[model samples]
Target: MAKADNIFNIRGRLGDFIFCQRNGKTYVKRYSGGFTKAATQNHPNIKVGQERFAQVSRYVKSLKQQLQPYLWRQKDGTFHNQLMATFLQIAKNETEKTFNELIHELDSYSSLSNKSLNKNSKIDPSTLLYDAKTNKLNLGIIPYELAVKYKGLFLEVATGWYGVNDGEIFLTESNRQYVKLDGQTKNEDQLVDFAPADDLDGQLPFVGLAVVYTDDATSESPHPVHTVMACFVETRNG
Candidate 1:
């Protein structure tokens, strides 16, 4: 089956059809059908493609599982599917690209990049500072525009390791800190820290951030109206 151009402006496999985009146009195509198992196995190229697809799928699944805490609140189900497709394309077209190089490429990419944490959030992630030595993330003063409306803020920091070759990922540590948007807390800087073991070998380290705002400070299941999340640093890549 041929790749689709995402005519529906969607991605992933829907039943037998797969949706995708190429250039600026969107198209849809059947990803599966009209192929016997024995016939497919007879073609070496098809077998190789199938193996590659399976490997990509496994790697992407592990990646998504590791990032679930940051992305579970996301409503869009297609995010990971699109992400898988992007990784497949990279694997097929750029075999020489290292995982670090791929990370760098994704840093500048649109549509599937981690840069778009939350569109509704007033806070700009670029404005937040990361201190390498102290392992502290400083979320500078929340602006007056956001401070007046939402009184509760949640900050999360997570660090992990990813093995590109094996598609294995480990969540080393996570820190969750809360702040009340009152006169004292909102006026001062907020900080969160993460400390993971230094013994993780043969894997790249990644640190991620999540910031959410809610109206009820004490609500156990506060519905976050504004959410911000991103992986700011990959120690190996940086």
Candidate 2:
């Protein structure tokens, strides 16, 4: 069905039709009927009035479209996140904390790319060994999984549209390209010789780690002063 375009401004509703005002004239009519003069009599029955108001509320809400909000923070100390801090009323100075920490908590970090590596040579998944030699933090072999659900979309790798021949998997919808595993063919028999492993950026297929330090920003730090705040296999891309 095609959507109707009407210039009448909806004010409320009557029994079987909506109350609206056109160019300097008040009228009432259901969406499919012709406009007529609005009824001025008050609904004497309170129960009937409540039901009518409820119907009008649902109809009016259906016409609106909402947009998603994008939230982000700039630096550690600066209060640059106006979208959530002021508009959403989620941010308030109740505690003395840094802005960097606040935004990470609010926006929820997103991951980009992930890869599987040698499992035999991986470090402990629950431990973050700070390499004094390298001065960097690194993680090892992490397990991951990917689940795809298609309700009603005609899609398959190495196939084309109906009654057509295209020997490629179309890269649409988020450009999510799937690479065939080693020595695996594209469309032969649709049998599973091997499956591609999904990336583990921040989708949280498993728990991750968080670390904090109380250093004085000095060159030489003391022992036990370097304590682990949090430890897991999480890594953020963004």
Residue-by-residue lDDT tens digits, candidate 1, 126-185 = 445555567555556543334466545544444544343433345443444555555544
Q: Report how far residue 43 has shifted in candidate 1, in Å.
A: 5.6
lDDT of each: 0.51, 0.24
lDDT of 2 by residue, 12-45 (tens): 6556566665555566657565434333234345
TM-score of each: 0.51, 0.18
For candidate 1, give the lDDT.
0.51
What global local distance difference test value does model 2 have? Answer: 0.24
Q: What is the lDDT of residue 28 in candidate 2?
A: 64
State the lDDT at 46 in candidate 1.
81
The window of 10 residues in a row where model 1 has the poorest summed lDDT is 214-223
Candidate 1 error regions (>4 Å): 1-48, 97-124, 127-129, 140-149, 157-167, 181-190, 199-238
